[model samples]
Target: MPLSSTQPPTSTMELASPMQVLPSELLIEIFVFCTYNDAFFPLTLGSVCKLWRETVEFSPRIWQRISMADEGSIIRSRFLARTWASKSKPLPFDVDINAECADMILPLLAPLLPSISRWRHFTLTGEREEERTLLVSEEPATPCTDLVINFADYDSDDDETEGRATFTRQYPTSDRYTMTVWVHEIPASTILMPLDFTNLTIFECVFTGQHTHPLAVIDFLSVCPQLEAFYFWGWTHEDASLTTAPPTVHLPNLKTMTLKSTCMTRSLLTSIHAPSLTQLYLAHLNVDFQLPPYYSEDGDSEDEANDPSQSPSSDHATGMGLRTFLSRSRPALRVLEMDFSDMRTKDFRFVFSRLDVLEEFLIVASDMSDKVINLLKPYESCDSPVRVRLPNLKKLALYNCQRLSGDAIVEAVSARAEYTDANASSKLQTVSQVEVVDCEGFTSRHGQTLAKTLGNRLRLH
Candidate 1:
């Protein structure tokens, strides 16, 4: 019954064959998905066979996305450097320095800086003073296109101020294309470096303490002709501070801008013109204005009016610079979020009139007031509405506001929907949905009322 010697084995008696190997292209594709965290996988693959090591070594796409930290030891680092040099391809790399082992790691990285012209994203973190000195040294590799400098802290005793000052002074002279600098527990004065990023598209500067003259920062921003996004964070005091208004600096290509601190005056906002801005985020601002208490003509009193503390005041208030800013650059704004948690009710109403074409409006307040909610309600009216029109609005979110009743909110939304459907000239009504979040006293009654009013056009979360 055994098969003949010249005959092939019968199908039933045949031995199983190995699966076909994946093509080299497919293996490279899989390697592309691997990140710095999975670097060991590639390293292990390269060591498996001569062909795999050759494939991994010559693939610039593979080495381009590598993290310098992936090489575990000095020997490994040197090996990686040699591999990178042999490939000689521009690599998009991210170098993250391990703060715990920076002293041992930095020297290894020093040699690779010369080839950093390929870098698209670079992040460095270590002991504050040590990392700053290392970064500012004359031997920095060619300035990268996108750079992020981060400071590492252990016990918070590091002299962050001095470190940041040194970095600021050194950074302006570097030929970096785009940069973001983040400093923790450092004052603005520590940023003594000149701002000379003429080709920068995105810039973010964060500090803890108030600057005597924030205009210096503004002056630095003035040099960037192509800057697109700018963010500023800090605290400012009124006394003995340089309050000179910044000259109007036009950011024609700017798409987003954010400012977070205490209250900012109208003059400050008006000074920066971003013709292409689509999104704006303002937080913890104080605007000095207040609303009058409701008084019934019949001598009957509402509970709120009976309490003197409930009456809003605008005496100490200042105007938001948003109004003047929008008057000139209103055509491009599509999304606006303003958090006036520190401002009085009267101030919110004045600023609300400035967001003319807002499609997404998010307002966060400290307390919900009937008057303030009523002031906002007219934007939804099908008939006479507020000065600011949101014809394209699709989503509106109100947070921490206690004054608006759920019923009132639903009614306003319904009116707005009706108005848009009937009056919109384009035949397709723009607004289709609305949302509200984290209102303090919102309940089932409010939810039901809102649903009934908005019908299919509303969602609650």
Candidate 2:
């Protein structure tokens, strides 16, 4: 974009100013700072001054981020995309494009097609199948490190609606390039194979409805051998009618995984082996809290849910699958967080015992019982000879654990805080901080008692 001759010329006094004497490198850095907080830097910094505009043009890093919001015109978006693509040469750029303008803007991104190989990260938000197809169709032979796709018109503020989930692919108005075709299931084929999932290290897929199948996910995972982080939100579940299990897909490099859907948890946890996994977060929006049957410390149990022969759809299947996964992976887990889940006490014991190095544990809105306290109870005082379950645990938080008694909470914290060896040395399992929030059976007196015992180490809310 060249400066127009009609534009005002610099004043003679301003030309002699100290600001005009700054080096080109310093000026380019200043332009970067002007737009460092924004993803659309090229659009704003190109019009500053003749020298500054040239500096921005010469610096590829300054023009490497491209973001298109919903409020831009098609012509403007196309112009900005072309300008940035031309200036950010030989460097991989992070691209974020909202799907709302796909009809008008996507086709005009032809100038950027040849440079797609330099894309480091691609985020497509609220895209329909056709727009996604268009993106892949134009993509060059490049291997992106991160990819995020939202298959739904997702409103993060909206609560989960009732009924079977569904994906609704929307397009522009009929006068525009509208797509009339609709399918009951997501075109999973477009996701992995088209964009080449083999190179992706971090991937996230979110959908509106229960359209994705477990087999589709398995297929996706099979291709992503280098994936280190995988996150899925919304209806990624297996059809209960599908009794046959898919072959287990191994992700040897995967380290962080978050599954926020119940069905997805049940589907993926049982199917994937991630030997390098260390961080896991699981949440289920619709889990019924049924107390698990009692089992001796040795884990002998007769409950149907506890039986390994039970079907995958059983109330405890997800938890059981998680336990099996942790056992198989044997990851040096340092952080574990579970929320809004139905995992029972026995499942907790099974999972916790395997994580010998877990240093941070956060459990919220789960069907926790007194057994949870018993597990967290300092190992030195236990009747059994097993080492402390979480000897390395430094932080513990329990929120909305209604079944756990206040007395049990007190005892758990006291054990963690006061536990010491015969030589009066502090045990490694000593919890430095404890936070309890929104749980029943705790009063101000209980808070005062804990505060007095643990001092400021305890937080009661």
Name the candidate that leads on lDDT.
2
Query: Residue 173: error of model 1 in Å?
Result: 26
Q: What tens-digit string does per-residue lDDT give for candidate 2 at 218-311?
A: 7657756778887766543344213445468888888888877546565577678998888888766334333232222222343333322212
Residue lDDT tens for model 1, 31-138: 667635564456776787776788787777776543455234655665666565446365445444443343233334434544554544444545432233223233
Residue 306 lDDT, candidate 1, scale 0-100: 26
What are the lDDT scores of the predictions, listed in order?
A: 0.51, 0.59
Cα distance off (Å), candidate 2, residue 53: 41
Which portions of model 1 miss their true places by more than 4 Å?
1-212, 236-244, 264-267, 286-318, 340-354, 366-368, 375-388, 427-430
The C-alpha RMSD in Å for every predicted model, in order, reads 18.8, 15.8
Candidate 2 vs. true structure, TM-score: 0.56
**Which candidate has the highest TM-score of all?**
2
